[model samples]
Target chain A: MPLIVKPTPAHPEPPAHKIMPAFATRFGPKLAGEVAATDRLVRVNALTALCDALSDPEQAHGCADAGVVETLNAHVSGGQDAPTRVLAAKALCGCARDARAARAMVDAATPAAIQGACLNDAEQDVRMHCYDALIRLGGGPRRGASSIVAAGYPKALVEKAEKESVGLQPRALDLLTSCLGNEQGLAEALDAGGIATCLSLLGSMEAAVRAAAGRCLAGLCFDMSAKDAAVEADAVDTLCALLEDPDLGARRAACAALVSVTTTDEGKRRMVPAEPRPRDAVAAIIALLAEPDAYLTTTACKLVANVAVHPKVRAQLREDKECLPAIDALIAGPGTDQDALVAQHARIAKDAVLWEP
Target chain B: MANSAYTHTTSPKPLLSKMKKTTYRAEDEENIITNNIMFDRRVVRGNTYAAQVVTHNTQREVERMRYESERTLRRDATCQRKERLAKPSTPPPAEGRAHIKAQTDTFLEELSDRPVESEAVTQTEAILDRPPSPLFIPSKTGVDKETDIPGGDLFDFDIEVKPILEVLVGKTLRVSMMEVMEEAELDAIQRRQMEFEQMRNAELVEVQRLDAEASRRFAEKQRRFTQETDRLRQQAELGQKVAARAFARSYLANLSELAFDQLEDSGHFVDPVEKEIQDSFIPWLFDSVVETTNNHISSSSCVDALIVDAIELASNLQSDVIKQIKQKERARVFAVEDAQEIKEAEGTAK
Candidate 1:
């Protein structure tokens, strides 16, 4: 293919108005040439570079005009090797980072279908890249699968998130945890079953799953609307139960999550049993004060403080008196088995109730 | 106003020289205005009016092709000499006095001669003050000293109007060009708005597609989770049944061993000699063969009979244990079969 065009010397420097079009014209055919190259290996290498180039937002902006995006669509669907297809998807991910680039790709191809092909790739690496790219394309982390499920980019895009392979679910949840930092991102996530997924993952045997879910729920619990949604999903009850996870990391995450929940009025009601129970949210964290893991114990203190923030939660803690004694046991130690941080957290938790603001 | 001026001048210009009788008779403003400046003024005015008139004509021609600047330029250049005949800017600043214009001399001569003929009928005073006679004429003696109208300088305003004319022309050209550029700018804004709309619509479509996909995936996952839970329950049930069957087997073996030990300890205690006698002497055979058989209540055969009874009891106990083992094995097989059937049915339902 003739990709290069010699400039007419009659006008060495075309006016500013014509420069973009001139480059836009050159861009399309060159990419098409690369796509049409009979040498598969060469095509793959060229496409990798092309995808890499387009990942640059500036290059992505120009890609659509140059027909680069359309050709890339062809490459992605062109029955390339696993690596080649994955690379093409990685490029799309770069483009998806920019609104304009994402629009361009959407203009010419079905992102769902492309992602599905990458997802179906038997290679774990291929699937991983496809997922990463999906997240960039606004399928952001925990909600990425849900977004893909809702917007079937592929003609037959399947929701395999339930059977989430290794490396996908944890990463997805972790991403969503951070996504919750922004209001809009959190709203989007909540709309996409983020609450339910977190609830489900809370019960998962995998510690990573439990941890990510806990972190995500922690963010979710901060918002009243999300908290209400979580309550409907029995989030407080689930998280309160999770405070006793054998895995210290999971226990710490659960503690953090419960902190957000118990801070809310409804959460406090659920955590403090209607009838005094020794194994409720308050009792659970009290038990954690005796734990050797300083982080877990500290996390437990945070939950205790958070729960104690609620008037009812505070009254219940004072009524049970189990929490105070547990905390007293932790602080009364002769500094041998007791972690100072744990002791500090225990004091803060105690003060959180006794020294009511 | 320029057109009105052009039309008004066109009507009276031809009649100026041919007018046979009167000078300024009509008192209409146009006529009085004409009469007031008719002679020295008219002569000067005539040349100057022609120059001004020429400017109006050329300006109209230029205005006609204002949008096509090249065309207007060509038209102006093509008619330059013709227009210059009347206009001032060609040799500029009204070369009026130096030329002393031949037409000006004739017009004044006609005016000077007109009263001589009219003097034959009218009063001498009438012809003297009639606008033409007293007008200063540059003669062999001196320049027209009686007239304040600068001979050619009357039209010197044309030179000043030259720069003004250039400014006007530039304005016309600029307005048309600016109009075109403004229109282009509007078009660009509209195009950008359209592109934005298209992109926004595309994004909306993408969002919708994602929404559907999320629904579909969640539904699938829900189904899978349910199926998995069912599958796990079935597996747990199967594991429990296997454990129960193993326990039953061990318990049955212990029961059989205990029953066998009880039978061994509870057996009749018969001496070897007594057991041999009972085997050798059947009760009926001893009664028939021995005439001297005393009627003893307790015979030696009694211990032997007890020994035989004990042997019989032990054999029956072993058979019963064997039968129980068989029953338990059958029950375990039936339980396993039930579990397998349940698993198969569940798999098919799935």
Candidate 2:
């Protein structure tokens, strides 16, 4: 006779039902399980689901618990198919938004892995996804940006920004921006001719690409050599021209880049050259002071402060009927209740303009 | 033959040299017998035919035989000791009673010195006040029961489980609804967060615009004010720098001072305090006092006129009211007469 065995319930009482969002209950484990399956089609379907689910930040935060990050990381690092890897990278890009998952990915060396994939992946789309993931994971916990820089992604990003199509160029520049926070990253970006590429992109028709390029150049200007290289690349003219762009973001970024460019003494001198009777750079900055954007105005005020340190620039500003009065008005404090940050910087500019040798 | 018992060989057998001998003393050479010397058979010693026993034992053999004998004796002794130990010693006098008797308890004195009697005495312990109640055994009552009741007969499954099923369904529905509510709350919060961010960005842009506008207007106002101040100063400077004014000022630079000094010396400047009091101060004070008096009179007269006009107006209003009352009385009488006449006419016509 067959032996009759009593079956034991895992719990004496039914477990208190966990009230989870229906989507989490439905997709959380299914995605993880299918991703863990050895079958390629199953993983692809699961990753596609994950990519779709991750578009919602709430789900992205919830997806970390599904243990899909490790599996996605495996697909990225392992010799998976390009589309699968691309999907994995895209999912990781979403997952990287979650702090805990981002820390996990960084600790697991996923940034380096993604950097490697971005460089080595044959498919352009896969590379793009990897770059996106890397950029997201960059500058996060565990010195994520330094790790990407250490992985030599900066030069690669610069090169890609230079050679890639308009669509991909912004991503590359964004990656460069994320990576080029330190001196070494800045050096690598500079050595890769990033300044020239960014200067060229300053005139791009795409506002986003121009903004990205402007941000990259702005980031590069933090280092002395990189700043000098950018100034030498005639970036001032391009950046000054960008100040008039219709896009607010591009204009702000250009203003910021010019601010960074004028940080050094040489940059200051370059901003207000001695030779020309008409210096459009200073005029562009002066014009920005009148812009409706207080942030841009504040930045223009800072640029003026930096530029007005030059005696010649100060004299020229005093000579310009509009520049000094506008600055004086800013210095005079807001007639209404507003942010005094702009007024404060304007005072500094006024002081600098009025400063003697 | 005895005298020729010593035999000599012409060649010497190989032998060790004694040239490095430690002793210097000499001894009789012929007394030492060498292997070269031989004794003749005719010169035999007494009892040569006696038996010569050949001993077969070497030192090693003798030692081996002695060790074997010693090992046998040691083994026998060890076996005997082991047997003696294993013999159990005659059962220890039946649980060592005799040994225990021979031993003395330290707390109880042996008292062997005292004579002991052989008589035995009995000692008893009183019984417990009450023996513990006898172990309880529940007595059997009715006959042992065994009923084979069908499960359905014991309880109605559907009727009994309805509440539980209801609870389960209710709990499930409540939990699902709660989950949906939580998700909706999260979504709303997220949407609010996004809206807040967008609002913040837009507000920042607006604030910047407003600030810029304020600054520009302020700057323009300041510029225009500065221009006005500069223009005024320039006009003043231009007036001072006019050729006629310059020539006149140059020609009369010290003349006004001299003339004013000479006039002051001649008492022509006068006592300004006295001059002000007599000429302008007195006249102004007198005119103000007279004008104040005149204003008061005119104002009082005007007030009297207004009072008189008010009285006349009040009187006229009273008279008009009386006339209107009288006219109303007359009209009422007339209306009554007309009504009466109309009534009479109606009667006559009827």
Candidate 3:
């Protein structure tokens, strides 16, 4: 006699996909399977636990390898409820923080889902997370903005950036900087007035905003046309003005940018505006060399190298003979990583000084 | 000065030139690892400065720089305010928006009033509805028109003689001579084309000879240009090196000359930025700096430079932390939005 059991049918289960084995012991099949479970509560519990486990840097890589990215992506991007989707996206965000995991998601379905949420999702938090996820993956804040600016010169984008929030504007300019990393990008940046916009932002009230603008300015100095544009925009004077700022971070960033601007012919010509004898920056920048700041010293040395290309600036530097011993001291000092950066620039600038005319 | 005892060495092989791998001295490495600020210039050259001197110089320099920058910022802000007061008041937002819309869309306004973007390219104008030509007699006559239309005379009348002459003489010598001359000279249009090709060939030969000479001249010019550029570059490099060293020396001199006060009783203004810098960045900076400078038990450091670097590092750290937190929050929000989308989709599926 066989006892027949009739199955009660109410909620139909999803078709099961082939399950991949979890590589790590802590997140074996049971936890992994729980994320894919049809039961909502079970999935949530598993996701939260896995997300917590991922907080430890030691476990991030292993979890990513355990195929958690795909499951998280599905939960985040698939037909999960708002709260569940939020939790899943948060967990995915944690994963995105780790570069390797971010890359894994990039190859998976995460980007499209994240982008979709950023664009179409009604919730502000959800839109924000999508933007964060994209940035974590080095795809920039707004991929559309990045790609649009990338497609041609950044004219409209720079104008659009001006009206945006302080944070978004800098990011947009930074996006322009990335776009300007190549020769073509340089051409495009020139077309977009990147130099002018960045120079304008150099005087921003916010230190963070100024730093971003300075960074973009530094990037633009790499190409000839852009360098020419920068010259026209009075970048040298503006950058030098920033060197005198009270904030050391902005000053250092400004000095770093000055290093690039001063490296070119146009940069040298514009080092001091066509003003009275030499510019005040020549002295202010020289003063920076004596400071203990590694970044400032490095850039100051490089700026001097560029400015010294002008005989007037060179004469000024020569008049102040102590720079020789100062640079010499840096070269012969105990070599730390910071020392290496300072010493390298100091050495190059020193040679430029020591070169017999 | 304490720096005099160090006996600075000049390696004819320029330091940091060409950016080769850095060669570190073993003693230097040991000093770094041990965090010992030896009396060595490389370890700590500013040990000569008295503690009082270091403090005085740092405080004085920071105050002066702060004062100068603040004064300038205030001046600029006030000037802007003054300008705003002088100008007419801006319209209210709703009115302003309406004004902007009107300005953009009103077609009857002066064309000059339209604000053109500097880099914007103009779209090419297109002809939408070109009319068909009545005399488009296509040149693609696959079959000879004379054979198809039996109308040789219609087109052949281009150089016809009178009908009376043709009937009276029936191909007289004068008429035959005119026809021979026309055939020999070729069509007037055809003759011009042949002449042009011949003239062009002669001109081309002459042009080729001139081009060869010009190319030689160009090559010479290029060589001179290259040589001149090289010379200028070399000179520029020399000047740059000189300037770099000079700037460093002057800077060090200024650092050394902090005469109890770098400012000669510079007038003071109210200090506001100082508090923000101290509260947010300076204390943490001192914490890290204590460790950085701690390595040198006996060695002394320049407080002026140290404070600046510490301040910079602290400022950068704060910026980095802020960015990190913002990123984290945004990532979470985006993920939730994506999940919500999925949820909506699922509901529809159900």
Candidate 4:
């Protein structure tokens, strides 16, 4: 008997678009022209290729020309065509990392339209692109301040700012916070129930909301009248409650707020309770250390450790045995000193134990 | 001896003359011998020599006279011996007859030893022995406790057989062995069996009805589910159509705005065709073309090099929007087709 063998045919090479840099570079300049011609289908294909090419930082700068900036700005200002305008907005934002392009986008009259498009566009992609543009516009010095103040951010955006600030494009809440910096704008936000809104956002289920609210409160805490308003509004209790928040960023913000509020002698004295009275605020910090989340636990430990050393607050700490086990458990666990705040607590706990008789 | 010999010859002649006078025949001689053989044999064997001589002389005459008798006796003895030899030996019939008679006598003796009751009385007793008492013993004490009477007291009076025997004589007698009261117990058992059978049949019918009802309910649920699914499918179709229309309008609007922006930037301004188109045409047109082209090919291509190059700058923007819409449509279509194929395959397999 004879054996028969079958040979496998060679696979064909994929089409040119499927190929890499060579085709991209070869066709890049031509595709850029096609994108400018307003041929919808051809422009989509070309821009898709261009975006791919722009992923490389070196290639990204090349795509950031004045013509591209003009096209993007035109689309952003263009009404009714949400899908195309959104795509253009996103590409412009991507290219806006370049200083010149970023400045050009800021100078363009369509920043408001882009911001509006982002907030209200029917297409999710277009709205997301508007968000991307806003983030880019607010990321830097030149247009960051002005564009943030000009963009009439929606309430939903502020709510989103509270929930997902980190995952959010950087400029979302930052822009809102920067807008709040203006006295008139701050007074308006407060007048428009912005204080209650911020307080409510601080208690949001989302960590980002708590973090953004905390950061906003920190900024607002600088003004003496704002501080008085915050204290009157019970902003301290809200911030202290956030010390047990699951998100690391929110917990860190709470710790920072506590540190800032206690920095002044008068601030410390005000936060401290009257003599022989229990400090519920200090107890709240001690309770936060019992949270299961490592970040919240560590932050709470540090806050308590700081409060424990205060002459006025020391008597309360010595009386509370609950603080001792949590301190011991934190020091016994791995990575106790990994975080600076946790390390500070460890040091304070060591001193507190050492100074005991 | 000579004188006797001469005399014997002369005597024979004289004897012949004498025989002629009485003519003794063979038949007659045989008869005489048959009659005297028993005594003649004894006389011949008992005589001495002298007596034998005298007897011999006498015997000669007698023998001559009784020769037939002697011959007949010898022949009879020979026949008896031959007959005895022919038959096998057996006990006598008289002994067997005696034994039968003794057996009959013993049977009669035993019969006599029985109580001397009359035949009618025995017959009545046999009949009475067959029927059990209708009354039952109330307890293990063997007393009719319900009546406060001992069981033995029930049959205390003697039964007279004489008058009954006279009445029964020459009449046909019937003896029944059946227990009379057992018939009622049999009837009760039969009634219980009928009731149990009725109950069993009713239960079977009820079970079948329940099964049918369950099947009906199951079919009803299936029909309801099918109707609900059809309603949902129609709603989903309407939603998709609306979404598509809105998307198309948005695409067209954006295109016009882009074109207007370009015209504004150009050194030479072109005349507008339609105000709506002028403001929204270029961007919308760009988005639509990109969406259409993207539906055909997902990968970036320079297949239509000239056309592709003309829209290269805006292609990424348009393609992003197109990709999202096309992806959603593709998933919907694929899911519908896959579900249809799966249902068809399952039907075929079943």
Point out where model 3 deviates above 4 Å.
A1-50, A56-92, A109-113, A116-136, A139-164, A167-193, A276-279, A321-325, A354-356, B1-350
* Clash totals, every prediction: 17, 1, 25, 41
Candidate structures ordered by lDDT, highest first: 2, 3, 1, 4
TM for candidate 3 is: 0.40
Q: What does DockQ give for each predicted structure?
A: 0.00, 0.00, 0.00, 0.00
Tally clashes: model 3. Answer: 25
Native contacts recovered by model 3: 0.00
lDDT of 2 at A214: 81
Query: Which candidate's TM-score is highest?
Result: 2
- lDDT tens string, model 3, A249-285? 6786687677666555567777656675334777787
* Residue pairs in collision within model 2: A294-B208
| Alpha-carbon shift of residue B177 in model 1 (angstroms) | 58
Ranking by TM-score: 2, 3, 4, 1
Q: Give the poorly placed runs of model 2, Cα more than 4 Å off.
A: A1-30, A52-67, A77-83, A119-125, A273-279, A329-338, B1-350
Better of 1 and 2 by TM-score: 2
lDDT values of the candidates? 0.59, 0.69, 0.61, 0.54
lDDT of 1 by residue, B1-350 (tens): 66541222223322222233343443332332222324432343323222433333344446544645675567668787687777665353464545333564535544344443322232233432443323233434211223233345334666778989999999989987876686587558644653343233323323333453476468779999999999999999999989988998887878866776776556444557766766765655786556434433235466557766766765575466445434544654767776566556446644
